[model samples]
Target: MVDKSARTPAETKDAGVLIVGLGRFGSSMALTLDRLGQDVLAVERSPGLVAHYSDRFPIVEADASNPEALEQLGAREFSVAVVGVGTSLEASVLITGNLVDMGTPQIWAKAISAEHGRILQRIGAHHVVFPEADAGNRVAHLVSGKLLDYIEVEDGFTIVKMRPPRETQGFTIEQTKVRERYGVTIIGVKSPGQEFVYAEPTTRISSNDLIVVSGHSELLERFAARP
Candidate 1:
């Protein structure tokens, strides 16, 4: 377990996730990350939004369009910043551009339009998300209610992180024949043993492990329901 309180200055510098503009996308992103044990700082122009999430998340009250606000929030130091300014396209673009200028790596922005997405790409955003599209998928899957997180990396391959059924806790990769069974391969296991998981075939599946498998989404679903 990472000792959050015992973190040194070096550690603190290494550990940072910044969120600019606390609308629905930003707020949910912050909440989800905080729930997943990551320290998140959300910066919003509105004082009301800042106050609402201040107790749960570290928040800064500042205008995202202003470069000075980025400085105030120590934006340059973040390892990955989420510029989730969904309300205004201009504000989202501005925040993303400023973060790029400041050399913050791995910025994920929630965009509304094709032109806005293109602008974000030109401004050096690492990832662009469409929240309405995501919400629709989330809602559709809620009825199905099996998938945990569906991350479309590239090509036709999608990374589905899901919970295994009760029976497969102590099984081996070879024993499970996961690849042949589901038409998808168990790429990795994110075990909560102080760090991340491995895709090694020999790695045993534990009950608490977060199985991060990659393949077609359809095949990934089969793996999610198996023993």
Candidate 2:
């Protein structure tokens, strides 16, 4: 661990999301959350960066690894906090430890390596994200023509949008019995030249139609890959 002096200037405001670090990932997360009407408090070690983003949202110039600074900012009270110091593994780990010690309910951290991710989780970070790996997976999924869009709603289940394969065209929902046959649920459908409709027993599926389905990822992939 890198040793750094503690500094805690008085602060008066609280935020729904506490963002530590001002790197690309942190700044983007802070800005996007603020734009989405979330109360966001961003912390940065560099005064220059704090000044750079101050015009957009509330920013604090402080070292996230300093426990005093974190406490002064009421870090323990925030429901969610994200540690975005992947470039400096030491800093990331230190900040994650501080957040965990402060009892931040949910801590999401960015990690540059698998070992770094494991360390964050061991220190109680509720979630860890490898942005590069995640983006690569998304690109691979798209390139492989698996689906038009994919979003994992939870650990094992996902929601995906894709055009029906030629084999399933002209089949009614009841005839397909997707839920029973493929272990996936067709939640919604977009017919040719028409807006999307919720899936129903009588709804007819065509090759050109886009379907939105939700199920275990493996099952969904199997269903999508059928010849």
Best by TM-score: 2
Candidate 2 per-residue C-alpha lDDT over 48-102 given as tens digits, one digit per residue, 9 for 90 to 100: 8877887887777778898987877667767889998899888899999999987
Worst-scoring 10-residue span by lDDT in model 2: 1-10
Candidate 1 matches the true fold with a TM-score of 0.65
Question: What is each predicted model's overall lDDT from 0 to 1?
Answer: 0.75, 0.83
* Model 2 TM-score on a 0 to 1 scale: 0.86
Reference-based TM-score of each model:
0.65, 0.86
Candidate 1 scores a C-alpha RMSD against the true structure in Å of 7.4
Query: What value does the lDDT take at residue 15 in candidate 2?
Result: 40
Residue lDDT tens for model 1, 32-110: 9989999777777776776677778677777868887676556777789998887688888888988888888788988
Q: Which stretches of candidate 1 lie over 4 Å from their true place?
A: 1-12, 138-151, 159-183, 186-214, 217-227
Clashing residue pairs, candidate 2? none
Give the CA lDDT, 0 to 100, for residue 20 in model 1: 83
